[model samples]
Target: MLADFDDACGKIGLQLNLTKTMFMRNGWVPDAPFSLNGTNISECSSHVYVGREVNMMNDLAPELGRRKRAAWGAYKSIEDVVKKTKNIRLRAHLFNTMVLPALTYASETWTLRKQDENAVIVIERSIERVMLGMTRLTQVRAGIRSSTLRQQSKIRDAAVYAKSSKIRWAGHVMRLNDHRWTRAVSDWTPRNVKRTTGRPSIRWSDFFTKSFKERCDALRVSRTDRTHWTTLARERDKWKNCWRPLGLPDDQRESRSRSRSSWALVPPRKQEAGVNLSFGVQSSNKRSFLHFLSNIKTVSVESIFETAFTV
Candidate 1:
């Protein structure tokens, strides 16, 4: 196991030259390729190896604290190393092609689950409708007061043709304001309607509310002063321009490019175990390498938790 240490050190740019420093000369060469003699080796019993490893672990405790404080700086250092060591274009392709597809697959699985839940809700709604068919229905009608009935009729008429563009209910109501029938006519004009050359319409309910009248008095700005859809459209265009540097293509280009590529989306392949790919066998080991590290971590954490919360 010790014979491989020098190669590992070389891989991480920690190679030591014996003549360069006194530490190396004092038989503490940190990057010696191998130890043939007992010069850098301990000839003690089994306890010596455990003691040295414990000391190494103790040294790592301060390193762990330092790493926690400077995590972002460490991340930038790692990114720099990766950029220096790998092909940038290949990395981009792997991220966009492979990693993106895996992420999309996971997302689509969640979406599919949501769709299934919605389908179940629809089924439940249909069952409820079927259950409602078992109940008996009875119709009822009564005579309405003259003035209230007239107002209700006008409201019903306005609601019936609400979507009609040709019907100018606002103009009709304004012309009939001098007539007695105008008292029964509800404010048929839209509440938030904009008029080019006329006074803006007010809510009929607001006439009965003191607080709403006070609020209207305070708000002196006209409807034209408020931001509208045109403002939002300009902001949307600004955002679209901001994303232009990501090399996204127009819809036409995207369609044409996708047609040329033979990419496909399929359900992820999940094997129980021992499924051999061209790369390697899928060993059915219950524990991962991370599990071993986690076990060691849990022991340290348990010690801390025990000390802190002892009854």
Candidate 2:
């Protein structure tokens, strides 16, 4: 790995700071020690790269905290304007464009479990409660619903927004040239690794298949071709929503009904092991080798997800 990196750096007229660039790995695999250019590079438990924290265990708590703090900063930066503005639409728009983006930055790649999703939901609702000028105490006393508050402010659901972003990115990845690492990594299956009995670790791909359960199954079955997918589908007027088996996957639809807690979303049903969706999806085993190459993996995160809005 080091040799290949050194060669690439040499070609690009770049030199890696061996002392500063240490080794970091996700928890999915055992750690492997290494020397760079025959010099040993010290190992570390965790490191922050391009703003997101990566750790040996790939745990998301610290990253969530970082995003939460960033989101708070975004809100506080415009607090006066948002709180003072009488136009609810503008306040909601500001939150969606600024605060939500901070909270969900790089969210498409997140592999969150139910508790994590609930935690994110709580964070969003906390901000939303403030947006509506409703304190936690007042909300509890009045039995106010989260949906009611969001409806007034036109706020989007955090979980739904993140998941739909993933869906969109999946579409973009599906249409990529086969030679691309992002495409190769998405399609790569780990032949050496075997599943241990009992439970399995989560993958980013699970974020899509496990989201809507049977509705997703039906979606893949109906739209077996990539061209029919909302992201890949070019015929917006014809086959755009056609891939959505039940109008919009329930998770993607903004919540409009009264729910005491915004976090009361349905738990994602576990996919039966080895039962792959019919969307021609493959196992994603990117972590084993791709983390070291993430800087050059895709065209750009913004380009991938932003184009989905066009479809």
Give the winner by TM-score: 2
- For 39-69, candidate 1 gives per-residue lDDT tens digits of 3432211111111111212222322223233
Q: Which whole-number lDDT from 0 to 100 does residue 34 have in model 1?
A: 26
What tens digits encode model 2's per-residue C-alpha lDDT throughout 248-267?
Answer: 11212344223223211121
Tell me the spans in candidate 1 whose CA falls farther than 4 Å from its real position: 1-38, 42-60, 75-311
Candidate 1, RMSD to the unseen true structure: 35.4
Q: TM-scores of the models, in the given order? A: 0.13, 0.69
Q: How many backbone clashes does candidate 1 have?
A: 0
| Cα RMSD to the true fold for all candidates | 35.4, 9.7
